[model samples]
Target: MESAAAQVGCLRRTSLSVSDVEGRHREMIVGDRSTWSFRVHYHSGDEIVHMLAGRAMLRIGQSARRVEAGETVVVPAGVVHRFEALDQLGWGFVSEFVAPGAEGPGPAKTESSLIAGVRAMLEDRYSLRTDVAQIADACAMSKGYLSRRFRQESGISLHDFHMLIALHNAKSMLKGGSSIVEAALDAGFYDQAHLTREFVRTYGFTPGVFRAAWQSAPRLPSLTHH
Candidate 1:
């Protein structure tokens, strides 16, 4: 990789790749960008990118490496990185992603006390009818500050995390033969309709469909909570 920003050009393209494993697939990303810069971010899987043209400033952790045509870079899962295209010719890259393992740890415990306390509270009691404002008040922090800090440190908004907890519990109850309405109430939702909406939005299907499908399939592995 080379770092010559002035010479970089914007590029746009697409690519496709197939996975070797049956029923598994990998997406191919081929693009040329003369003017492109991405914020620092991370992926859940490992990625290998082959530079086809021009150059790019690839930041992995705190180091920036210049990659020119014919070179390749491998980024491991969970490592933060960013890309800056260099040259008017832009740079073309083809990437392949590798899936990472399941059952990773939860958010680090070294964040602020407010964040840790909120996390613990949610883990222990998300099934109760509690909202963000109440949680913030209990933690002696403003609602706005709590929301911002939670997202910045945990990579998920406070509301979404609560929904996730609810959904996890609901799924467990469903597997135990609880009715949708009963599971929804026990999981802190207002009613069956509320549960159906979030369930469909998140899982792309309704709870009834899921239960029927699950009955025909092998039991899923136990869910690991943080």
Candidate 2:
């Protein structure tokens, strides 16, 4: 189990893998792409991507690494996953498995007051930038306390929640054929590059790559945000 990217070494074209996926229960899916990437989304169960050719940057959550021909990237159940083709053409055999009791979007979360306020700011007024200190001061608490409590209650940091909201809306706009600049500005990003940077950081692909992929692929799953 070496680093997949390290093993890839470079984004050069390779022979497509013709090996068959071993299971029958999971539906076999075959596909290829160039200058494209899957939308940032998660499944109810684990997903296995067995690379057939070329290389890709596979992002699970915020970290990404490369997977080349003959490599396999397995995304844990319920984890956000995406990948960008890094070579002329990358294809793969994909099997997504829905595990038992994976129904719904997990258990309900009881929102604490701190989490509620932050959620309101991030989800309700996502277009405006809200300072962490301002939230802290309003609650008569230190920023440190606010952030820690927010994370504990929400299972995510305040900054990430805000970023997710922006990214989510930007994605919606992009899928609707909005230009990158329009999506960025409307989603509260300073510019297209800002959205691209955050998108790559979170989704492992640039906005252009995502748009290209979205045009060809049918609707994919996304987070069930509040």
Candidate 1 off by > 4 Å: 1-116, 126-129, 219-226
RMSD of 1: 12.0
- Full-model lDDT for every candidate: 0.60, 0.58
- Model 1: per-residue Cα lDDT over 111-170, one tens digit each: 467656775788677365557888888978898988887776655567666676677678
- Candidate 2 stretches with Cα past 4 Å from truth are 1-113, 126-128, 137-140, 154-156, 217-226
Question: Each model's number of backbone clashes?
Answer: 20, 0
Which number leads on TM-score? 2
TM-score of each: 0.46, 0.50
